[model samples]
Target: MPEQFIAEESRSIGHAGRRELIAWAFYDFANSGYTTVVQTTLFNTYFVGVVAGGVGGVSPGLATLLWSLSVGFANFVVMFSAPVIGAIADIKACKKRFLLWSSIGCIVSTALLAQVGPGDYKLGMVLVTVSVIMFAYGENLIAAFLPELVPEEQMGRLSGYGWGLGYVGGLLTLLLCLGYLHWAMQQGMGEAEAVPVTLLITAVTFALTAAPTFIWLRERARPLPEVSGERILAASFGRLRHTFREARRFRDLIRFLMTLAVYQSGVSTVIVLAAVYAQQVMGFDTQSLIVLIMVINVTAAVGALICGHLQDRIGSVPTLAITLAIWIAALLAAYFAEERSQMWIVGNMIGIAMGASQAVGRALVSKFSPAERAGEFLGLWGLVNRLSVIVGPLSYGLINYWSGGNHRLSLLSTLAFFALGLLLLSKVDEARGRAAANNFLACGDS
Candidate 1:
């Protein structure tokens, strides 16, 4: 290629045009309701106390075990399949198409959760698994859009902007659900009746909020020639194999992913269990549980927005390291806290750590990804994170079960994950990784 074209392409490297960036971030706003309502607060408790207990009369311990195992299974599926699907999306230039179908899958399944009631634990489990799978796919698909929207320098801010807004979305959804739950109980509805309605509310929120993403965000990658039809699957695997064979080029990405896997395990565990801990350990009832989560969302939004700017100035690794240290400290505080007031402090700390760590990790992956293979690589990032989701919750569930429901002891597992993550983070070289990604775009792809 001529030097003129290289110069022009370099000049074109900046933020997305028009409202594309806003639309992209709004997708985060759209999907967060599912995780907030279904995964974290309402449904998990309802599933354990009502659905699992109704027919066969499952032990609460066993119900939690089942819930954790189910979460593990769903993420396990995403863990192995995300890379191949991502590779396909890149080669087909159909990231939007794939995202749309996954969104539909999640919305439909999530709404169907309203149909679950007493004696419907099996149905609940199946729907939960399907919704989670769809949600994970959509999350990875939308993140693949990140590298297309901004240059590496702005990635942290953009990523942080989305996460911060996402927490607000989560907060709003929880407030709506909390209000409805309160009204339902006032109308003489019990937990069984009120909880399923919240699931429906979450589904509707996701669909309505996600529309702008499909309408406004453009698919920028051109499809690779001959990588269509039946060959798409073959090409996806081929791409994965090629990526692995080129391991030397992406060594830092590999290292950082290992770091992410460890730390995000801790994060995922907190997300999955926070409500349960509040309810059981902190003695929070439903209304109080919802309020606690609302506080977390507020703190998380602040952390994401503030640390995003900090990351741009100080670099991603340092920002991530700081968050991990916070996580370890928060876990220790949580373990020792005997009062609800103390747990509230610990919850806010976890929220801040959670938002910053997640935002920095996403932006750092964007820094390391080659432009043409952004989808495939972020898919790999999803793969590693999903695997952590499996390990994190399952480990916590097992500890809780083995220790006779001792949640305090189980909290130690999250602290260990953070410690391991911080150590592994030191091994990654951000500058070298960015240069390698740029060199590929400049020389290999061109």
Candidate 2:
């Protein structure tokens, strides 16, 4: 491998190291094309209006519910498999291979989503599910590589930058789709035809953006000192068992994870539900939702950068607690916002807090996990991260289903997660918690 491709953690950040961070950040740019174009705005519109035939005619609401549930289930599968895959990379010395395959899966799955069309509800759902499953799995595995690339202190900054890049990426893709839509209209194409083509472009963007990650990023997968005659599956199970057994050594890490699971669920559900709430319950038109999302993304970029720097300075747990408090307030405000403009204001506020909460949370995890098993640990983190979505959105789905499709109560119920997470997070001691995490890794290696 070329020297430029190798991601040496010691040399990954600083004035000289910014390029590496940029490369890392670029991954978000590529992935967000799929997120924004397919997951959030364009595809959801297409799925409902075209595939499901809108409300009272197959209802886009049903498709959205299935999409969320499918993503959650796919992550569950990846969680069960991650430790084994991660353990093999650790033992067989194939970290890059795993990352490569995972990225390819994301690219292929997303691009394939372009193939399903109108009147193909079942097929479209299957394609969307498979694509998101691949994307979720890839995201979990790719996250593990970040710790291997950057220095400990700067992890927060890079994580923020990655999310910032994601916003920028999403913006660019949205712009491209807008251009395509305009062109299609000029050429006398109906809205349906224009949308399918735009969806295809979204998938293409994922493939193009992901190319560099495969070509540029490199991992050394430092060799483990302990030798094992055991096969990969046995070794994975053994390490997983040990991780649980030794977790008692780091009681604070356990507390932190539990706290994060609860609060972050609130955060995750809000992000997932906001667009839907805006379109459905809030009664915002398509153009209004687009504008609001752009505003949110821009503000979110600023939020992530500022909050991330503060996290590095003040402390992760404290920063997170503050952000969660703000989130609780934001959700409450959203629940009551009567005017459309007021809802938009609430979204902008969410953007501000959203970046900080998510970026810092990931940075804190990177700060704790052993660099070698970062992938496996992150996989577990992804498990809880995804499980929250399953529980939060599914409950919301049930509410929506039960209330004769009333979305307001379902949207408001997410607040319970924030309140619960706040209580649990307060129990965590930051300094002692991180130290315990390090000690666990030391004992494992010993």
Best by lDDT: 1
Query: Over the stretch 1-446, how does candidate 1's per-residue lDDT look in tens digits?
Result: 12442343246664465367778888989998999998888898788768885453987677777888888999999999999999999999999999999999999999999999987888888999999999999999999998887778878888998999899889988989998998999999998888999998999999999998999999999998876789999989998999989879989999999999999999999998888878878899999889888888989988998888799899999999999999999999998999889978987998899889989999999999998899999999999989998999999989988988888888898789999999999999999999989988888752
Residue lDDT tens for model 2, 1-446: 12352344335543224455566677778887787777677676567567765532565556556656665666566656766676666666666677667667766766666666777767777776667666666666667777777766767777887777778888788788888887888899875667778767877887787777766666657655465566656777777777788787667767777887787777767766677778776788666777787788788878887877788889888888888888888888988888887987798788888878888888888777777777667776776676776677677766776676677788767888888888898887878867765676677672
Instruction: For each of the candidates, give the backbone clash count.
Output: 0, 0
Colliding pairs, model 1: none
Candidate that scores best on TM-score: 1
Model 1 has an lDDT value of 0.89
Task: Give candidate 2's error at residue 324 in angstroms.
Answer: 1.3
User: What's the lDDT for residue 79 in model 2?
Assistant: 53
lDDT of candidates 1 onward, in order = 0.89, 0.72
